[model samples]
Target: MDPRESLIPPETLPDLLAPGLRLISVGLNPSPASVAAQVYFAHPRNRFWPMLNASGLIDETLSPSPDSMRRLFEAHRIGFTDLVKRSTPGVAQLRAADYRAGASALRMRLHGLAPRAIWFQGRTPWSQYLRYTSGEAPAAVWGLQSQTLDGVPVWVTPNPSPANAAFPLDVLTAQLASLANWLARRP
Candidate 1:
């Protein structure tokens, strides 16, 4: 299927979601490359998909395409969404209002879905999310936290954007491995 026909407008990628998900991975927002391609983590250099596979969170080396995402929800019991749905060249282009609105929407969405876990791909959105949900700033920490959204566990991980050279692919892969371990231990 033409991606355009299967997804939201190219300017805004739709959430890849389903009920009763084992995990719901949340990104800060869609990058311009992702928006243009109408695929999540579409940038050639983005490590999101590769890390997921490496960590055994996903069994297949999936591409950032509509079919793969559908399989992620249906077969893997995983879903993808973003704190912000808007497309921008970079996160630097996002404003405070954008984050506030995104956080609010995400809170409601998570509360309703009540996934087993909600994983934030970066510290930025996770911080904003804590503020949005708790009405106070949290000393953000990477990895699983004691926080929960509507009873769903919250996890934070390093951003996988190519621009984030601070955490190399190996580091991100390890982080994802931790997330997989957490999920495995869940009752």
Candidate 2:
């Protein structure tokens, strides 16, 4: 077994969040690998770190680790969380109840943090969040959405999970770049 697995807690991955965050990236849920490593998007093929570095959002390249993520939160004011906290081998293990609870929890966190904008890693988390909170999941596009989470702007990007092969790294990078450009214009 990997040494990182010894660090895993029963609650799985912990949220990397803080007040006054400029942006928050929300994933669908934590994978077992991420939980073991105690890092979001820890999987080698996930493309999250690579896409983030290539998007020009941050000046430095970040490897998948707790320290790198902490630097992102502290230095860049970019936080990380998930629609669901549970770590599972696959999305098929998740249930509607999970989304419901997670959405409520996420709403509370966002309200408390009041980040300038939210960067959803995929449409599922955004749509599920909307569905659970509003009783309807509106059709969404790939970039910025017209909707806001209680006045916090929302931006959606392709899921960086390697399982989501429909989108390549370049596509994900471009989408993140768009979000970066939008953030640059924010007050």
Candidate 3:
């Protein structure tokens, strides 16, 4: 086993998913901090929660925690999942096999759940998903993509990880707001 495997907890993170979800946010994978906190984007510096709230996607602000995630699901019809289920200190620890397996599993979930739309938190998850599932790594631009995943509309946004400082919180919020607008326009 990889030395990093020893550092990861046996339970990484669970997918907050349900049938007929209006939108599902897909991250590259769970960070060690998120796994430890039992919440998605739990790192203190991560901008996901703040950006999500400022985006006007949901009326109330939500902190990174199990209850907040449940609120997003039960109240707003939003959900969360990751391309890879494993928790790693950094993406460098992930292997090609991990992406392949994750992409396969994600494909199955998307087909089964039939979420109205998918919001990929960063380019990596979508690129890896495509490469592993269809042998295609198309250039991914931010915002909604022409391609659909099993007929579900796909949207991309800059990662909210603190490490992705290039995209400030405002930009992330704007991207998410655009997604919310699109969701509203959908029948």
Candidate 3 per-residue C-alpha lDDT over 108-146 given as tens digits, one digit per residue, 9 for 90 to 100: 877868788999999999999999999999999999898
Off by over 4 Å in 2: 1-8
Tell me the whole-model lDDT of each prediction, alpha carbons only: 0.86, 0.90, 0.92
Model 2, 1-187: lDDT tens digits are 9999966565677787887788999999999889878889998889999999999899899999989988998999999999999888778999999999999999887786788889999999999999999998998789889999878889999999988999989999999999999888988
TM-score of each: 0.91, 0.93, 0.93
Candidate 2 TM-score to native: 0.93
lDDT of 1 at 71: 85
Clashes of each: 0, 0, 0
Clashing pairs in 2: none
Where does candidate 3 clash, by residue pair?
Answer: none
lDDT of 1 by residue, 2-22 (tens): 768955556788887766889
Instruction: Compare candidates 1 and 3 on TM-score and give the better one.
Output: 3
